[model samples]
Target: MKLTNINKTFGNKKVLKNINLDFPTGKTTVLVGPSGSGKSTLLRTLNLLVTPECGQYEFEKQKLDFAKKISNKEKIFLRQKTGMVFQDYNLFPTKTVLGNIIEGPTQVLKEDKTHAITTAQQLLQKVGLADYATAYPHELSGGQAQRVAIARALAMKPKYILLDEPTSALDPELELSVLKVLLQLAREKQSMAIVTHNMVFAKKIADKIIFVENGEILYDGSPTEFFDPNNPNQRIRNFISSMTLEDL
Candidate 1:
């Protein structure tokens, strides 16, 4: 998928400016920056949760002109190809873990109930939550809930998974658990784009690192180059220093 010359605004404030990016298949792209830098908004655009006011989005050979109104069918089509995991788990309070995972497949995709259940079970096991099938969101720890959320996204069989601060709400120990599951996904070559502040985890998982600030991308390149201690970009150097100190 690719975005070309995309721009977005809320009220009078521009949130994303002239953005051009590409998310390669079976690779992980990590977006990092300080608060209010538009990383989350950029991630949302991938799932069509937030639409750009200008430019085009190309997915699977289909191109959408953002300047024109997008039909509901087009939005649905785009969304079906992408799964989004937010900072909060956003699970249904009344549904069990298994129910939550199968809802999309059974309802939206109209998959057979039995098959959806089978797939949900396998996904739960993949995320290390096989034993918690009957657990409710309220009954799980932060890490457990996030894992369930990931499983739910996977059950939809999306082409790409987009995560926004997946571990931001957890304590360090719980955060580590969630990060491990994400790392495992990266190893399996799942196509993913993540918005996060965790520099260490970003360094570990990112195939490409993009630094956005003030609604514009300042850097986009390989992780090795982006994370190099001697990186010449002063802005990146300062941002990394601040993030590292914040983590400490």
Candidate 2:
């Protein structure tokens, strides 16, 4: 997927500014920056959850002009191709884990009920939640809920998986559980673009990193260069320092 000259505004504030980016297939692209830097908004744009006022988005050989109004059908089609996992697991309160996982496939995709159930079960096993199939959202721990959220995203068989601060709410122990699942996905070369503050995990998993601040991309390069302690970019160095202090 690719975005060229993208722009978005909310009220008097412009959250995204002429953003140009590319997410290569079968690679992990990590979006990292301080809070309110538009990382999450950019991730949302990948799935068209947050539309830009102007830009061109190309995904799966289909190009969309954001300057024009995007139809509901187009939005649904794009969303189905790009699965999204939020900071908070947005599971249905009344639905079971299995139910949440199968909803998109069975309803949106019109996939067979039995086939969807089988796929959900396999995804549950992959995310280490095989035994929680019958459990509701409120019954699971934060980590478990997040895993369920990941499973739900995978069930759609999307071309790309976009995540926004996926482990922000978890403690170190719980965070590791979720990170392990992500790491496994990275190893499999799943196409993903993630907004995260976890620098360590970003360095470990990212094939490319983009640093955004003040609604602009200040850096876009390999993880090695971006994370290098001796790098000359002052802003990036300072941001990393602050994030380290926050971790302490």
Candidate 3:
């Protein structure tokens, strides 16, 4: 996908500014920046969750004219094409793990219930939560719940997934479970855009790195170049220095 001259404002605050970005197919791009730096907002814009006030958004040769009304067909196409995994596990409280995973495919995609449930079971196993299929959201631990959420996103068989601080709410030890699932996704060559503060994890998995600050992209490069101490970008060096030893 290619975004050009993207701009977004929330009342008096300019959240995204003349931003231009790209998410290439079959690669993981990590978005790194301080809190309130518009990283998450930018991810939302890519998925069309938060529309930019003005921009030329193109994906698969389809463009969104934000200056004009976005039709329901266009909105649905974007949402279905890119699955989103939020920081919090957004599963339905009343649904079991199996129920949550198959909802989108069965309802939105009009998939056969038996086929969707079969696919859901396979996804659950892939996330290492096959036993949790009958469990409700409240019955699982934080890590388990997030894994289920990932499975839910996968059930749609989307072109790619966008993650917003996926492990931010998990405990240090519990983070490994979701991170392992993500690592497997990376190995599987699943295209993704991730917003994260975990520099160490980013180094391990990111194919491309994009650093945004003050609503603009300051740097975009390969993970190797982004982490190089000799990198001439002082802001990136300063940002790395600011992270906790644990974060690195």
Which prediction has the highest lDDT against the true structure?
Answer: 1
Q: Model 1: how far is 101 from its true place, Å? A: 0.5
Model 3: which ten-residue window has the lowest total lDDT?
239-248
lDDT agreement with native, every candidate: 0.95, 0.94, 0.92
Candidate 1 on 75-140: residue-level lDDT in tens?
999888999999899999999999999999999999999999999999988988899999999999
Model 1, poorest ten-residue lDDT window?
239-248
Of the two candidates 1 and 2, the one with more favorable lDDT, higher being better, is 1
Model 3, 83-146: lDDT tens digits are 9999898999999999999999999999999999999999998999989899999999999999
Q: Alpha carbon lDDT of residue 178, candidate 1? A: 92
Candidate 2 per-residue lDDT, tens place, 8-30, comes to: 99999999999999999999999
User: How well does each candidate superpose onto the true structure, as a TM-score?
Assistant: 0.98, 0.97, 0.97
lDDT of 1: 0.95
Better of 1 and 3 by lDDT: 1
Between candidates 1 and 2, the one scoring higher on TM-score is: 1
The TM-score of candidate 3 is 0.97
- Give stretches of model 2 more than 4 Å off: 246-248
**Alpha carbon lDDT of residue 147, candidate 2?**
97
